[model samples]
Target: MNLALLHDSDFIDHDRVRLTGRRFAHLAGILKVELGDQIPVGQVNGDIGVGRLERLDNDSAELRVTLDTPPPAPLALSLVLAMPRPKMFRRVLQTVSALGVKDIWVINAYKVEKSFWQTPWLADEALSENLSLGLEQARDTLMPQVHLRKRFKPFVEDELPALLQARPGIVAHPGTSTPCPSHINRPATLCIGPEGGFTAYEVDKLVAAGCQAVHLGSRILRVETAVPVLIGRLYDSCAN
Candidate 1:
């Protein structure tokens, strides 16, 4: 863990706080933190801070936290992705968060297997754990918000407009008139389809809803590869 993440409950009544659970093990074993060492720390939705290691025991460690600055602003893009297989899901979540994406919508698609929706990783606790790992790796304090859409049509036709407000929207398809733009400064909502890609009908619906169809390249990419590639390119473009 690059950053030590804490919850409100993790703080003691006093300024002292104890690190237990997974975090304690990580610091002790993985990071091998020593007393007087200052570690990057943050609350789930709170400020970024430094934790001065004051004490350590077999099961827990105590620290003095000095919260100072807020975390940097989140990425300007939100991702709409068709749910991938369970094994790929964890990596995708981590990659997106590490890239600073703060909002995600995982939706059903024609090529998506129905059993994918049954994955236990979709549960809140599991999802949070995966996302937290990414945040810690990136030294980011804020957790991304995740939304699941079981029905595709209503989400695209009805709910997507509000999210699209003030943001450019693109639907990633294999073949389209326009290639996906390299870097975008303004906030954008990007939709990526399933393995075989979105059905023509789905594409039509999305296009009608004000989403422009764009392609990454002629060759198809797995969701995991495509997501980070697209996000990184967009981030670089925005930065330049």
Candidate 2:
């Protein structure tokens, strides 16, 4: 973990926090920190700063926290993705969070297996777990919001129109003639399809809703890989 993420409950006082469980282990076992070591820390959905280790024991540790810096700026983009396979979903969640994407829409598509929705990783606790890992990895504190849409037509015809007002939607399709726009550096809604990709009919519906389909190149990429590539391409903040 790049940052020790402290939840609100971890705070014993305004400037002190009690660490236990994974965080405590990270301090006691991994870092092997002592009484005076200062570590990078952040409050969830709050601020990024440092925590000075004060007390250490097998059960827990206490740190003096002083938060003065804000978290990284969030990407001005909304990711609308067809729900990925369960294994890929967890990685995708982390990747999205690490990239500073604050909005996520997981929609249904023709090729998406019904069983994919049954994964426990989509549960509240699991969602928070992966998102936390992502945030800590990036040393970012702002959490991304995940929206689940089980149906395609309703989401496209009803909800998508309203979302389009914020920015023009860009749909990633493998065979699209137009190359994906690079360094867009503006608010945008990105629509990614399923493993086998959205059917032609679904693509048309997204287009009708004001999304322009674009392509990365001749090669196709897995959801986990494509997400970062696409985000890096679209946002200057991600470009190295």
Candidate 3:
């Protein structure tokens, strides 16, 4: 973990935090940090800073923290994704969060397996853990919000229009004539489909909901590969 992400529960007082579980193990075993050492730390949805280790033991560790630096700027992009395979879901979640995508919509698509939604990774606790991993990797503190929509048509017809009102939308399709625009550097909503791509009717619905259909050349990419590539194409950089 590049940054130790602090949750409210980690705090014993305004300035002190107690670390345990995976975090403690990492510090104790992997990092092998000594007492009095300062480590990078950030509070969830709060500021970035440092924590000076004041106490340590096999069971836990204590640190006095000071938060002042701001986290990296969040991407001005919203991701609307068709549910991906269970095996790839966790990685995708972490990838998006690390890339600073604050808004996410996981909607159903024709090619998406119904079984994909049954994955434990979609559970609230699992979601938080994966997102935290992403934040820790990016050294960011702001938590990204993941929205699940089981019904594709309803979401597109009802909710998506409103989301697109503020950030104009784009949909990534493999063979579309319009190539995905590069470095738009503005707030945008991007819709990506399932493994085999969205069926024509579903693409039509999304297009009707204000998403311009675009493509990433002739390459057919897996959902996991496509997500980061598309985001990189749309924005100047995640740190921006």
Candidate 4:
């Protein structure tokens, strides 16, 4: 992890922050942080800053923290993804977080297995742990908010309109008249499908909901690869 993140509860005393549990072992062993060393630090949902290691023991380490700037602005896009298999789900979460997406919706698809939803990783704490690892790796403090939708039609037909008010919407499909734009300046809500991709009926629903169908290219990409590539293209477009 590039930045050591702490929760408000983790603080032990003024000018001294204690690391216990997994974080302690991560610092002492994985990171090999030394006393008097200044390490990157941030409070969860707060500012990014530097922490000076003041003391260390077998159980914990203390740090003197200096709060600095707030975390970077979140990506300008929100994602609506069809939930993948459990194994792919973990990677997708991390990938999106690393790319700085702070809003995500994982919805059920026709192709989605019921068993996939039963995975322990769907639990709030487990999801948070995976997302936190991504944020920590990226040196970011803000955690993405993730939501799950079990019904496709109700979500697209009812809730999507309100969500689109803040941004333009696009749905990635395998074949579309318009290719995915290289860049986009405004905030966007991007919907991507499962491995088999969205059914024509599903794509039509999203289109009717104000999402324009677009394609990455002729080539089909797995959910994991498509997410970051699309995000990067959007980011680059905005930059130009």
lDDT of 4 at 7: 87
TM-score of each: 0.95, 0.98, 0.98, 0.95
Q: List the residue pairs that clash in candidate 4.
A: 183-237
Error of 4 at 100 (Å): 1.2
Clashing pairs in 1: 183-237
Model 1 Cα lDDT, one tens digit per residue, 162-224:
889977889999979798887676799999998889999999988888899998878889989
lDDT of 3 by residue, 84-117 (tens): 9987989999999999999999999889989888
- Model 4, span 1-240: residue lDDT tens: 788888888887755688788778888998898989898888889998999988999998999999787987788777999999899999989878867889999998888888888999999988988898888888888999998999999999888897799678999998899988866756899999998999999999999999999998889888888988888888863243
Which model is ahead, 1 or 3, in terms of TM-score? Answer: 3
- Model 2 per-residue lDDT at 195: 93
Residue 71 CA displacement from its true place in model 2, Å: 0.7
Worst 10 residues of 3 by lDDT: 231-240
Considering TM-score, which of the candidate structures 1 and 4 is the better prediction for this target?
1
Whole-structure CA lDDT of model 4: 0.87
**Candidate 2 structure quality by residue, lDDT tens digits, 65-105:** 98999999998998999999998999999989999998999
Separately for all candidates shown, the number of backbone clashes (residues 3 or more apart, or on different chains) is: 1, 0, 0, 1
Q: Name the better of 3 and 4 by lDDT.
A: 3
Q: How much lDDT does each candidate structure score?
A: 0.89, 0.93, 0.93, 0.87
At residue 59, candidate 4 shows an lDDT of 95
For model 3, what is the alpha-carbon lDDT of residue 235?
Answer: 89
* Model 1 lDDT-worst window of ten: 231-240
Cα displacement (angstroms), candidate 4, residue 162, comes to 1.1
